[model samples]
Target: EPIVEEMRRFLDKGMELQRLVPFAEVMAELAWLGEGDRDEALHLIALAEGLAPTRAVFGGLAAWRRLLSPESDPGETDGMAEPHRLQLIGDWRAAAALWARMGAPFERALALLQGDEAAQREALDIFEALGARPVAQHVRGLLRQSGVSGIARGPRQATRANQAGLTQRQMEVLQLIERGFSNKKIAAHMAISPKTVDHHVSAVLGKLEAVSRGEAAAAARASGLV
Candidate 1:
């Protein structure tokens, strides 16, 4: 059931791309089949044929036909065609490795298909450095399934403390602090008086339960508040 849900999510993302109809159609068929709904699978194949008149769709539909009828032509399963093969013949190893590190298969595959390997790797590295182990592990399993490999492991876990809420003004102040702006600089940038900036900073610290501005900034980052 988990695999089915995962495949459904993958198909959803593929459909979102709009241009990758062959991949999207194939995944849609796989999702329906995973759920043991043969009628729905055939319906999706017909939809795919309408959406993208390509050999991939024909191949996929043929595969489904064979599934529905065992004595169907053996020529239907001719493996991935040239274009689809070219699409798949990419840096899957690196993609898998990065996804493993990030602990997100769906995101990794999307990035790889979009040719955003560097961004994917950067995200994984950040996740590792921040000790997001559960996310990393989940990504690793996804990467393995996608044929990605050789990912490096880092810190396994990190404690995330709950953060106190801040008003919009306090949040603004914290963003400036994270930017290494002095109170005076923050005041100038925000068009507020220095004294007002100081007051907001103090309120931010108090509400966030932090003794220092740096701690407030770090807390905001961890909580995704900034």
Candidate 2:
């Protein structure tokens, strides 16, 4: 409880300063500490949001509460910020549950599409459990739009790429390039020369038949190479 008390003091100070970042950090610490004490956490989160209704604090507080109680109403908060936060943190189950609770078919479909297969299936299952057939059907439609036949059932198995294509070293270079890493950073990661990294990137681009590195990355992702 000392930590909570300390966090509260910090929260107050941050509010007095009208500084949102410190207040957001303290609210996050409080949420983490108040894991089993969800009612207290919710109260603290409400206070934090009331202090500065900024997107960061609102999203973080909503995410913490949704993680703690997924069946709570998603519309209790405004906008897509909280849902996106949950997705970014890989708390897809809770995100799905919140969407289900809100009974928003389009939002549920979007959540399922943005998540991995396991998460999509889990969201569908939750919708089914809620007896939300229309939502489930919407989700199925989204999957079909993405060229996927039905709800993603499980994780896709990794397959070995054609050895005749780019080598593992080339793939590494390609991934780094796509991530916008500079030659020096790529060299540090691969323990190679900047020149060598540049050469590998060129090779990857040529092999992928793409004009630009960005295009090559898009092609790779489309081909399920990355």
**Highest TM-score, which number?**
2
lDDT of 2 by residue, 77-189 (tens): 44546565665465666666677688765455445645776666666766656655434544554456667664543223244333215566677777787788878998888
Specify the poorest-scoring 10-residue window by lDDT in model 1. Answer: 156-165
Model 1: per-residue Cα lDDT at residue 203 = 63
TM-score of 2: 0.30
| Number of backbone collisions per candidate | 4, 0
Worst 10 residues of 2 by lDDT: 155-164
**TM-scores, each model vs. reference:** 0.28, 0.30
Which residue pairs in model 1 clash with each other? Answer: 96-148, 100-140, 103-139, 104-139
CA lDDT for candidate 1: 0.53
How far is each candidate from the true structure, as Cα RMSD in Å? Answer: 17.0, 15.4
